[model samples]
Target: MDATPSAHAAALWVGLHLILLLVLSVLVVRQRRKHQVVLGDADIPELTQAVRAFGNATEYVPAGLVAVAVLAVAGAQPIVVHAVGLVLFAGRVAHAIGLSRSGGSSILRSAGATATWVAYILGAVALLFYAIP
Candidate 1:
């Protein structure tokens, strides 16, 4: 079986992001244990924030991973793959930090969202160019 650098690059970013997701999971667990709330967030601010952060990542990361993989497989340049990966990484981290700090809107969260969106858009457009022939 052979795999291109494109898949490898996507895997690299996916692995990194998955690691961060594990960290986010840990944060939620810690919050849960600290608050003694076994199920749900229990309406605690910290726990709620932690849960939402983790939940948000769950909602976004999987789709983003697929989009990135498709884009890479569809022949995006190596540099483009890496840049998208980096942006996704930074965006997820920043958004997590911002959410942990406050549930409300914040600069880091906003910037992180924009970066994530930009990464996806770039990947999609680049994939179109490569795929449409």
Candidate 2:
């Protein structure tokens, strides 16, 4: 089925997120192999952060994609869709870098968290304003 142009915008975001997920997965795998941890993080902070970064992406990326779908279905502009995608991608990357550095506190972590939350809120509001009758 050929997607409409707006759907293509959504697809672009989806594809980008998928690539991000794959990268995060590789990071986790490398962390595990390096540390030789079988199941869990084995109390290693870097491994813990790697796992959590990937885990966190699993939690948020799908929801963001859903929002993108809604926006496309609702006839949102492609630029809006791209904006959402860019923010989500950048947020995850930032968060991963920050978390990979430390399990606790970091400016990148905080900024990434903020960007991620903003993307979520934007998506939600876009649904409300664009889709809801």
Q: TM-score for every candidate vs. truth?
A: 0.93, 0.92
lDDT of 1 at 121: 82
Q: What's the lDDT for all of these models?
A: 0.86, 0.87
Angstrom error of the Cα, residue 33, model 1: value is 0.5
Against the correct fold, how does model 2 do in TM-score? Answer: 0.92
lDDT: which candidate is best?
2
Check candidate 1 and list the clashing pairs: none
Cα-based RMSD of candidate 2: 1.4
lDDT of 2 by residue, 15-120 (tens): 9889989998999999899999989999988889989999988988898888888889889989888777778778888988898888888999888888888888
* lDDT, candidate 1, 1-133, per-residue tens: 9887888898899999999899999999999999999999988999999998898888878877887787777877777788878887888888999999999999999988888888788767677777887
